[model samples]
Target chain A: MTNAIEVTGLRKAYGSVQAVKGIDFYVERGKLFAFLGPNGAGKSTTIDILCTFLRPDAGTVRIGAYRLGEEDRQIRGMIGAVFQDGLLDPLLTVEENLRLRGGFYDLRGRALTQAVEDIMKQVGVSDLRRRPYGKLSGGQRRRCDIARALVHAPEILFLDEPTTGLDPQTRKSVWQTLHGIQREKGMTVFLTTHYMEEAAAADYVLVMDHGEIAAKGTPSQLKDAYARDKLILVCHDTARTAARLREKGLACTETADTLELPLASTLDALPIIQDLREEIRDFEVIRGTMDDAFLAIAGEAIRE
Target chain B: MMGFALRNLKVFFRDKAAVFFSLLSTFIIIGLYALFLGDVWTSNYEGVPGIRYLMDSWIIAGLLTATSVTATMGAFGIMVEDRGKKVVKDFVVSPLQRRSMVGGYVLSAVTVGVVMSVVTVVLGEVYIVINGGDWLGASELCQVLGLILLSTLTNSAMVFFVVTFFSSTNAFATASTIIGTVIGFLTGIYLPIGSLPETVQWVVKLFPPSHAAALFRQVMMAEPMAEAFATAPAQTADAFREMMGVQLVFGSTEMPAWGSLLVLLATALLFYGLSVVVLSRKAR
Candidate 1:
């Protein structure tokens, strides 16, 4: 597949602090690409540069065939951005907000009205059409923001923490709506999120830390790399078993009543299992998680 | 561009404080003027008769409309709100032309000006007729309307320029009030510019409101433009006439009126260009 977004050696600094330090990544067309990072890890900054809201100090960004700087207008026309903030006017009704956005693309009259109605219905906010935007709940406001972004029918959608501050159920609904749009329109979606579950939903993921890409691959690829082969040992006292195993030169972590150990091979796990049967109440082997991959790559717990 | 302009107008009307204050303030000023000057309308001042005094009432109405509407905090509100909400980023990235965006804002200001002017004219005329003064004829009424429109345009442009370049709403407000008050005093909105000190008269004559007031007085009070020109010294009159001659070359002989409009249009264009440049640089 052709790349939808290509960036090379991107570097951005704020005074003495470096925000994006020579990071590189590419996102394939028509795929949902997730950018995972900590709060100050330059996710928003990179997205800003890509969305034409900020000019990169030094880098090459190519969205489709258009280069960043040289073809910003054309690139901007092809992309729709839902920024971190809800940029809708508080004074305008939901429908009015959409109509005003649609006007930017020269849509007006009956055509504009119909377009707004269709988008609102598609986003499941048609009932709130006449309501002022400030009156809507957080989720409804985000949905309206998304609909406004799509008013111009852009080829790519850039969402910067679209579900931040949302409840779980609302976040799920937003994901579902985004998935529906992607399925129906085949628009490339570039999303930045702190939620691991949201990151797992992407077709590909790029884990960022300290202004650099720590790792990039499919979710399963990352999981397999860090956690595919793992053995879980449940015992009467996990701490005792963990100490005994460590004393015997085995790597293990105790969690409540369970002991987890990274096994080089299933054959290597058999001896430990056989020897520890007396101390173990139960044992099982399982696949790894995206969180484990992130921890392994960033050298820190995902939640922290 | 039409969409932008219409949207701004809709938003302005939806603002309760803006709509209420604009209409309320215009009526309050006219009511106060009528209460104080009701008896004076039937008496003669200088060589002008009582009817002429009543006609000249439109000048006060026009000035009040211009001062109140042009001194509105709407421009600052709009710009500051856009900056705070980051809505300006959307426009900067959109395909909408920069000039069109400025035009939309200016048009919104003009709409407010026109609305306020209409309210003052209607209420002021009602008071004149009810208090035993002759009603204005169609031609005279049209002249008053024209003058009000010109004054509104001029002041709106000035406000637009001030709000565009200054980021601080407080600073804009302070500056607008000082400028508006000074112009009002120097032009003798409550007195006569001819009675001001020579230095103050020179300074006031340079103000758009002074020219605007003079033009309005000429049209509504039936005073000859030449008589209005005499308020300034001979050298100043020559310079003023030459400036008017330039306006005449552009197919308009209403010097003070057209001069204010031209200055307003030019300043609007300049502020708009500067805004675009600043936005572009910041976007980078």
Candidate 2:
């Protein structure tokens, strides 16, 4: 199957600072690809180049078979973008805003009207069609923006932090809408999000840092790669167990009431488990998460 | 492109402040002209000396051109606001051709300019008639109206070119006003370009407004087009015809209306074409 997006040796600079450092990646058709990064990780710059909002200083970007520089007009037709800032006309009603966007794609007459109505329905904003965009709730405006992006039936949608400032319920609604689009139309989605939960929803994730790809894999694969297989032991006699573990030269993290050990193997856990039975009241072992993978790679906490 | 243009027009009309300011500026200039020159307009053309007749026409022409500059702010602001809001981006990525966008914007500017000019001119004429003056004849009125249209078109092209390069509304507004005011004062919109130094006259001659005002002054003061062309130099009938051709090229209405129209068209096309190229390059 053809890739939805392919970037080779992409680089960009702003004056003296390099924003993107020769990064390369391809998004598979119909799959949701999430670009997970910290605040200054170059996600936005990359998205801008792909969306045709900013020119790359070097390299090639191809959306389907269309090259970025050679067939930009054709590439633009197949891609939809939800910019970081909502680009709606505050003076226009929600329906009017959608109608104007449809006009950009040359949709007119009855077809334009139907297209607006259909997208509004899909995004669940049909009732707010007559209200001015400025008066709508933040979530409603976001929904309207999404509906506008989809009005032209673009095959690849680029969403830049789509749920950045939304409340939990609103963010969930946005995620649900995105999921619906992906499932129903099989539209390839490329999104950038700082939210780990949102990143977890992607079929593939690219973790970026310092203008380079730090890691790339499915969410589960990342979790598996970084799994420490650790066990947490909560006990009344933590001092004795901690001393015993320290004497054994095992790596252990101790709290006021518990001692945690990084168990390298199941056998190592069994021996420790057998020795600490009387003092241990509770014990639990769990697999690592994408958050752990991120922390491990970047050596910095993800700014939630 | 039509959709964007029509939408821009709709927004401009919906903006009460923009409409009010455009109309207010036009009327204020016309009112000032009437208060200062009512008697001169009513005086018999036969008794007035030739030079004074020429000067009176020059002043009126400058005022008309100044009015065009004042009224175009609203249209220029609309374009600037659209760019800030990324509305231009939506169009840039679309299949719409660049020429259509330019045509649509120019058309909208012309429509607004024409409407404002008519209202201003009609009110100015009524003020003159009410103050014990006779109404202008049909041919004279046509000539004045043609001057107004041509001057406004030239002003629009100049403003459009400026706004295309300078995206900031404040910058465009400040620069256009400063430039327009300087041109108006130097060309003697309230005085007479002929009364200025030879160096000043040479400078004004290079600008479209100088010729535009000359044409307007000729019609307002009821001077013959031939008499206005005679202000420059003595020459062969063919050389005189070529000078008339230059006036026709820069003049609006009279014998050489098409020339001014072409100048305005060329300026509008060049600036608009540059705007398109800049916008396309900026779009990644």
Evaluated with TM-score, which candidate comes out highest? 1
The 10 consecutive residues of candidate 1 chain B with the worst lDDT sum are B243-252
Tens digit of lDDT per residue, candidate 2, span B26-135? Answer: 44445655576534532523343343334334344456666676666566667787676666665655555566776678777766776666766676566545543445
Query: Model 1 off-target regions past 4 Å?
Result: A14-17, A226-239, A253-288, A295-304, B21-59, B62-76, B168-187, B190-200, B223-284
lDDT of 2 by residue, A200-247 (tens): 878999988888998999988877776466788998688887887789
How would the docking of model 1 be graded? acceptable
Chain A accuracy of model 2 expressed as TM-score: 0.93
lDDT of 1 by residue, A202-286 (tens): 9999988889988888988777776457899999877788889999998887777788888765567789989998998889976
Residue B218 lDDT in model 1? 47
Q: What is the lDDT of residue B171 in candidate 2?
A: 78
Give fnat for candidates 1, 2 and onward, in order. Answer: 0.60, 0.42
